[model samples]
Structures are given as C-alpha cells and as structure tokens.
Target: MSSTEDTTAQSSIFKDCLARRVIAQPALSDTPDASSSSSSGSDLDEFISYLASEVWETLPSQLRALTHEHPVIDVDADALSLATIPGSFTDTLVSYGIAADPDSACDFLRSVLRDYVDEARAPPPAWSSTRTSECEICERDVPLTYHHLIPRSTHTKVLKRKWHPESLLNSVAWLCRPCHSAVHGIATNEELAREYYTIELLLTREDIQKWKKYASKQRWGVRRG
Candidate 1:
C-alpha cells in the first residue's frame, strides 16, 4: 500500500479504538435502577417505622402535637437538599433508626418535633442555663452555654434542611461550655476532625450522663455528694 493510504488506515483504526474505549466507560447520567432504589427505600421506611414505635412511643403527649402539625415535605422548596452537606447527619439519622423510606423518615421527624415542642413548653431544667453550670472539661466553674453535641451549623445545613427541626433535636446532646469548646476546637483542626467525628458518632445518652458525672466529680473534688 502507498505510505499515505497506510497512514490513513492506521489513523482510522486508532479512532475506532478510542471510540470503543469511550463507550465502554460508565455514563455519568445513566438512569439509576428504579426498582432497586425503590426497594432499598422501602426497607428504610420499615426500619424508621419500627424505630418510631420502639424509641418514641413513650414520648410525652404534648410532644406528639408537634409532629401532627408539621408536614413531611418542605413547602417552599421543590427538591430536598441532601447533596450539599456532610454524610454524617444522614448516616447518624439512619443509625438512630430513621428509615430510608421518605414516609418513614417523615413520621420519625414528626415524632421528634413533638418532643421539641414539649421540651419548649416546660420550665427550663436547672442544668439548662449555662451561667450557673460547670464545664465538663477544664474543671472550670463558670457560666455555660448550650453546646450542640452535633454542631448546629453542620446539622442545620444537613438534617434540618432536608428533614425538620425536631429530627435534628432528637439527634443532638447538650454539652457544657469547656467540653463544647474543646470539641469544636477539635472539629476545626483538620488533624482532629476524624477523632471528633468518631466521638460524635459514638455518643449516646449514657455517655452524656457519664460525662456529666465526671464533671460533677471534678467540680466537687470528691465522689457523689
């Protein structure tokens, strides 16, 4: 064959190979498997429903009112905003028994809101005000501020934005001032984010109670009483 013809043939073969490779690569916008997505979502819904019946069934009667009034879907927005924030909130929600099903997630949130409203109606507990409280860390006897165990800034952007305020509240814990500051500092330092994340992930009511006991012991410099 002529050199010119040979070169053209080689170029055509190279183009064909490149086209095949491109086609074999995954499509960025390929439609998700609707059946699989729906099934997974359904399972999540069942889980959330079970959680609601188990964990929230005994919540105060007043708290139930909050859930009954709130709608499941956001009225102003056309779509949920789950894509913009950290996955921890979502993961925690699921971990705490929020179902993957939209309806189940909504019901769980409704119950949570009811609890918040009930809490709001009652007189603030003695420990609610920070001014008279002691720090959980640093052994300082100083005024306290409510520290959201899961940072409010992060939570609002993630769970509340996607779900409701009540759901966020049920998922959080109150921290004394020093511990709050230390945790925030830890969270801010990139080197410590993982540790802070783990702390938040592992936190439970028992852990909070234990921390409070430790703080109380430190404050008095003695065991109970």
Candidate 2:
C-alpha cells in the first residue's frame, strides 16, 4: 500500500484497539485515582488545556448534527485547525479582522477559550433590535447588526447535526457597526462555526475588548485586528 494508505490503515487499527480496550476496562470515574487528583498545578493546567482543545476539535461534528442544516459540512476541523482550509481560511481570517497567517490564526484560537469561562461569570448585555443598545463588547451606541453564533456559512454543518435547523438560525447576538466589523475581521467562518461564536465567548477576549474600546473612542476610524 502507499504511504498515505498505510497511515490510514494504522490509524484505523489504533482506533479499533483503543475501542476494544475501553470496552474491556471498568469506568475510571467509578474508581478514581488519588494521584490523578493530586497532580501538580502545572500538570492540571496542561490537562485542562488539552481537554479544551479536544472539545473544540470535535465541536464541528456536534454542530452539524445539532443544527440540522442541509448539505452538512463533511470536512473535519475545529477552531485550532482553521489553517487546514488554507485559501478560504486565510481569506476569511483577513476579512474578519485577523492577520491572514497560520501563526496568527493558531495563536488566536488557542487563547480564546479561556475568555468563555469569564463570560459565564459576567455576561454582556444582550442585543436588541427594537431599542438602541450599545455594542455588547465595546459599550458603544453604534448601530448594531445580528451576529450569528454559527455563521450562516455554517448552516451546512448545522444540517449535519440537527433534525431541524431553525433553532440554530434563530440563535444570534447583536454587535455595533465597528465591533461587528471587528469580529468578522478577526475570525474565519469555520472558526466562528466551531468556537468564539457566542456573545459570552466573545466578551471574554480582552484583546477584542481593547479593540472595541479603541474603536468606540476614536472619531477618525476603527481599525480591524
């Protein structure tokens, strides 16, 4: 077999073996190891980081199934894997306000998750269409637009997950002109689909907040990230 084929075969075997091992083993949760809990602070941090990465990695599949949009995106990726979609990823990243470089995309996605936890503790104000509302992130009273937690571009991924897609379409937040522009400026459609799509998640990014604050105060112009 070719090298690529050989690698695929090996991966399949590895997964199968892992499945068999899991099937034969007792649940670790039921027999927790004391040493596991007693791990060093650095070790704990590493594990938590790994866990978050894994969650983002697998989120697209979940989104496809849950959102129930049609033509479900069959490609595999998470926020960290945005570089995989090179041409489109780079284009969208630049349009969204972030630098269109592999290093920049990877670095941004890696650190964005921690912001979500902070958002949970102190949520931003929800966007309203009927009444004037400040930008949720910058607190600027600029005109706001509906920002999808899952970009409309990702409706296909949603179709993959859900039996119905209406709920996903209905879910969105409001962002002021500059903040909204900034969001699209910093992240790609795939990245938004997989992570950093929610209002709370967005609020936690101090870097984005800095952008918003600067934009809100600047009369001349709002710069993209």
Candidate 3:
C-alpha cells in the first residue's frame, strides 16, 4: 500500500482501538481463525503488521531516526510539540481530524500500541542526580518531586464518584522538596485535585506564593517544616 493509504489505515485502526478501550471492549488484540471469513479481522491484522514494520518510514525522518534508537517512544515536550507544529506526520493526521492535537495523538497512539509506549508520554516531573531540572513552582535548581495534581490516593474515589475525568489523574507538577511539602500542607488531596490542579491556579494562593518566595531563596536540601 502507498504511504498515505498506510497512514489512513493506521489512524482508523488506532481510533477504533481507542474507542474500544473507552467502552471496555477488546480492540486490536482479538484474532480470528483463517476459516472465520471475517474480512474486518483480517484487515486489522494486516494494518497492525504494517504498523510494526512500515509505519516508521511514514513519519518525518528526524522523528523516525529518533524512535529507531529508543526501545520506547520518549515523547518529551519538544517531540510532543512537533505533532502540532508544521511538517510532521502527526500534524497531517491532526489536520485530518484523526486526533485532536499532540496530547490526543499521544493518547491515541499510547492506547493503540500499549506495549510499545510508556504508560505516560510526558515524564514524571521529578529531577534526578545526572539530569536535575528546575522546579516548576519555585524555579529552584534543586532536586524535584512529582506531585500528582489529582493524588493517586484519591483516584479510585474520584472516578467512582465521577468527580473528575480519568485524564486528569496523571497530571502533575514538578516541585522542589519544600514547595512540594507546602502544597500538601495547605490543601487536602481532594481540594488540590479539584481547585489547585494547575500551577497557575495553585500560585494564586497567598500561602503558596509565600512558600515559593521563601523556598526559592533556600539552598538545595533544605527541608520544609
């Protein structure tokens, strides 16, 4: 098949996979016996095979080269941006309404190829020794911790009660240790999940701002009270 035909087939299968997951049905993994005479099943398997082999060649060469070296698709911010920006295979797909945007594309691809991708496309907002990054809150050049916007502790209850969408469960903020402590100190997990999920929303509080200002000045390794 041609590249466009291959991409269109892949996108359709991917969308079907996503829809099946949403409604709690088996998607791509279902197989049909040769005697079953299920054309749709046979076609799906063909597209899946194409995905395993030829899909990489359909992508932008830079992205293809990048993923070729890594066992898992590491979709950092820049890579995610390329999905919506001009001149990318994902952009073309988005233009055709195959997915909403980068986030949606990531979700669709992740769901469709669950084993090949990480659980989450974005890295957890924590910092480490060799790859330390600045805190999202205090902007401190310190070790950071991953603060789940909707605390994992509350996920079951939240979903059970239909309090929030499943997508928000994995949303996160990268904070320095003290700032991280101050956030949980000021609000309950439920409150954080509902009202203070975003950094912009969290920064609106005087207490959090005060904490940021104070914590930003402190050197690394200073613990919060």
Candidate 4:
C-alpha cells in the first residue's frame, strides 16, 4: 500500500482497538478522575495553540479582525486559540470521535476551521420585515435589523461541538442600523457567537456602552461613516 493508505489502515486499526478497550471497561461512577481531567485539559490547550498557529493566518480576514473587545490581527496563537471557541474542550473532542493524539486532534480542528469559514461565507437568513419597538442597544425607535445574538457564521461549529444549545442559534436582537454595524465592527463573528450571545453580555463591555450612548443621540435618518 502507498504511505497514505498505510497510515489510514493503521488509524482504522487503532480506533477499533480503542473502541474494544472502551467496551470492555466497567462503567465508573459519575465522578471524574482529577488527574486525568487535568492532563486532558493540558493536552487540549496545547492542541488548540498548535492548531491556531497552523490556521490563524488562513482564517478569513473578518474572522481574524476582532476578538471580544480588541483587534486580534496581531494576537499570538495562544490568545487566538483561547478566544476562537468555547466548550469543554476534551469532552467535545471525544464526542466528535477525534483521537487524543496531537496529529488526530489537529486534523479534526483543521476541518472545524474549514467549516467555520464556509459558514461565515454562507448568506444570512432572510431578514424579517418586523421591527422591534426600539433598538435593544440604543433604545431608539427606528428601523431595525435583525442581529443574530449567536452569529450565523458559527452555527455549524456550535451545533457540531455542542458548545451551545441548539435553540440559542435562533435567538436574535433588534438593533438599529448603526448599532448593528457597531456590533460587527467591535467584534468578530466568533466572539459574538461565543461570548456576547446576549444583549446583557454585549452591554457589559464599556466600549459597547459608549457606542450605545453615542448612537442613541444620533437622528434616525442619519448615516454614519
């Protein structure tokens, strides 16, 4: 067999052996092993850092542009990895059938990253003509657009990784055009999807608060540069 085929065959055998070992093991109590937990957590962090280094630059420019409250273009791989996604990292990997080995973990992460990009590029859901009584951010009576609290771009990975409940994917906020633009301008889609998936959380940021104050004063028909 070719080298690639040989590697694939070996991987299949490894997974089969691992599955059999798991099936033969007795079920443990609900409590987890502290030492094993710590080790797995460390492994997850290392894998994320390595995967960030491998794929950070290749991420879409918009994906790399902003994080929670800061520009992330120059952020190091460690920080990028931490801010990229949220979940019980080790558990998510096992649930996805990704092996604990670094090579296997990184390979899975790369595919996840590709899915993230594809989702980010996908067209957003059709906007509803309905407008809330006011912008949730600025509290102004104006024409509003739907701002997905959990951004649509991260929907695929979020569901795949079980990071957030599926119901939360359809949650949204009504924001005036300016407020909606500011939301995207302030943070990347991943940040919005992972961290600021609610108006309360978004308002917690001082920057966002400042923008709300400024936006509230502007006339409804005014366009911001």
Could you say which candidate leads in TM-score? 4
**Count of backbone collisions in candidate 4:** 0
Model 4 lDDT, residue 33, Cα = 26
The residue-by-residue lDDT of candidate 2 on 1-225, one tens digit each, is 354543333232222222222112223122122124333334323322333333333334332122112333323233536543344433433443443465664544333322222211222234333536776776766546667878887778767866335665657777754456457656787777666757777766644643443444433221111
Q: Candidates sorted by TM-score, descending order?
A: 4, 3, 2, 1
| Candidate 1 CA-lDDT value | 0.35
What lDDT tens digits, residue by residue, belong to model 3 across residues 197-222? 88999999855654454345444532
Count of clashing residue pairs in every prediction: 4, 18, 0, 0
lDDT of each: 0.35, 0.44, 0.51, 0.51
lDDT for each residue of candidate 1 in 1-225, tens digit (9 for 90 to 100):
454543333332222222222122233012122124223333333333333344233433332332223344331242223442124434544444434544444443443333333322333336543354445443456444455544545654445355334444434334443245334432343323223333445243332322332233333211100
Q: Name the regions of candidate 1 deviating beyond 4 angstroms.
A: 1-142, 160-166, 170-174, 189-225
Candidate 3 residue pairs in clash (backbone atoms < 3 Å): none
Q: List candidate 4 stretches off by more than 4 Å.
A: 1-132, 222-225
Can you tell me which runs of candidate 3 are displaced by over 4 Å?
A: 1-127, 221-225
lDDT of 4 by residue, 1-225 (tens): 354543333232222222222212232111132124223333323333333344444444445332222333322232334334333443444443443544444444444443333322333234424553889998998667788999888999888988799989999888865567567756789888888999999999755764564455444532111
Q: Give each model a TM-score.
A: 0.23, 0.37, 0.41, 0.42
Report the Cα RMSD per candidate. Answer: 25.8, 19.6, 18.5, 18.9
Worst 10 residues of 3 by lDDT: 115-124
